[model samples]
Target: MRLEGRTAVITGGTRGLGRAIAEAFLAEGASVVAAARNPYDIKELADDHEGRLLYQYTDVTDERSVEELMTAACEAYGGVDILVNNAGVSRDGKIARLSVADWNTTLATNLTGVFLCTRAVIGPMTTPGKPAGPGGRIINVSSCVAGRAAVGAGAYSASKAAVEMFTRTSAVELAPKNIRVNCLSPGYIDEGMGKELAANERAWESYRGRLLSDRLGRPEEVGAAAVFLAGGESSYVNGTVVEVNGGLLWAA
Candidate 1:
């Protein structure tokens, strides 16, 4: 197992992409804490995984909640070896008609949430005498929309783009402590937001041809990339954006 005995904390891990990452980590022998505001059928996962899985009530946008989540993970597994900032929300609106409330909600959950969770994990991950081997790993979940332009997605795009930059800056700042920060940018997948978007015929038509693959990506594929980033396989990889978009081409 590449992550044998490691411990990871994943925000928004109760379902969708985050849950997939949790499963992958567990398979690699890493104890996982899936942090989210709701359990959302996670107990079933816990039942299946046994002692290796836990679900923590965490509001990534709340500093206190994020802190408590880190504390809980450490209490459960001794220390945290990885932190995946995957909790996010997307509010679709064109720039011209975007509401202030919507913008705030999007940025708070998507951008600020990442910042809070990452900041809260520093202590647990860096403290010596803990079991975190070879330092720490921070995986920030970005999206294909961060790099691609789309109508009525200004807020969503901007938040994710900012997350990419934040990942780079954090990678540099935390490298000396042996922590590697990286971004996972996933494209349309058969789960969560991607699933919803693909359900819309108009949206599907607009994006189908852009992908080299004829179908949406599978959730496990994103999880596979996440496992690579979290485990020793990516030891020398940091401050990089690994896209799991299945080859998307911009319209000419």
Candidate 2:
């Protein structure tokens, strides 16, 4: 088991890629604390994983709630060994037509939330503090659109771009303390959340041509990358953005 005695805190872990990552961690023998705003199907997760899992209702946009999430994880497993800041939202609109609320909401959840969650866990995850183990890990979920100029994704692109930058800066700052930080940017993932945008066959066909990969990426593929990055196999890796887009945005 790559994470035999680790404890992981994953934000936005109720569903989708986050849920898949949480399960992957559990499979690797890590105790996981999955956090989101809404109550989750903990009974099901608990039934499968038993004492190795926990669920917390966390609002990443709020500092107090984020702190509470980290505190709960420490209380449960002594300290956090891994932190996944994966909570994000998209507000799609052209820059000229975008409202302030739309931009703020996107930035808050995608960029600011990551900062809050990282800050909440840094003291406990680093070496020069009252921590359980030596050091810990951090993974920020980014997007391929961050560097790409998508027409209707101004707010989302900007927010993810911030996430990427923050990932690099945080990694550099935390490296001395033995804490690793990295980013995972996924592209054209086959998930229900974006189904409404490409609802029609014609729209999907048009979008499909742009992708180098023939099919959309599966959620499990992203989860696999997360597992690798969160594990000891990636000890020398830091400030890197692992693209799990099936080679769609190769250069970016």
Candidate 3:
């Protein structure tokens, strides 16, 4: 119960890495609000965790929707002590083939959403008198591809690279407010996008050699890293990008 009594708001917490992080936080005794455009069977999670979990419909790209999410979280669990900007979308296409729409959508969700959600949570997390305890935590989710170049990952990679820089900037600005911000850059995992990639034998074989572990990472592994970042264990850690990859070797 490292997170006992803490309140966390996770964007896109209904599935994939976000869902895994939600479950991990709940296990550590945190009250969580999972925000996404759709519930996507998150009711099952609510049922299992009962009072500890709440699902809110949120479109992170919209400012009003994000404000409502933070407001609702405050009303339900008092105030948010931790925030995870985990919402993202991937529209893979080569530079020449990628459409403006695909690039726009990818940036809107992957980069802009993080900006909005983080901005909205600042006030609540740093309420003058309330003082959310020792301090607040903000975890921005990035991808391993942020620093690696791939054939059809232009938009996704660009958006994520910007996110990592944004994480650093946020950390610097929010440090005075006692808010610690960090980025979690996950490598190919066994679920979500990684699962889709692994399904393609040719793609999997090509990328398999890059992983030092010689296997895809587990969702729980990413979730565990999230827990560490949000918990007291990482009090001194901030403005750093924690790579949860199984040691991916990128070619020059």
Clashing pairs in 2: none
Q: Model 3, 1-252: lDDT tens per residue?
A: 999999999999999999999999999999999999988998998898889999999999999999999999999998999999999998988899899999999999999999999999999988878854769999999999899888899999999999999999999999999999999999999998899989999989998988888899999999999999999999999999999999895422
Q: For residues 70-110, write the lDDT of model 1, one tens digit per residue.
A: 99998999888999999988888889999999999999999
Cα deviation at 150, candidate 1, in Å, is 1.0
- Please provide TM-scores, in order, for all candidate models, with all chains considered together: 0.97, 0.93, 0.97
What TM-score number comes out for model 3?
Answer: 0.97
Best-first order by lDDT:
3, 1, 2
Off by over 4 Å in 3: 250-252
lDDT of 1 at 165: 100
| Stronger candidate by lDDT (1 vs 2) | 1
Residues 1-252 of candidate 2: C-alpha lDDT, one tens digit per residue: 888899999999878788888888888899999999864675598679888889999999999999899889988988889999999998889989999999999999999999999888887686355544536899999998888898989999999999999999999998877899999998878775545535778878877766777678888888889989998789888999998876766533
* TM-score-based ranking: 3, 1, 2
lDDT of model 1, residue 40: 99
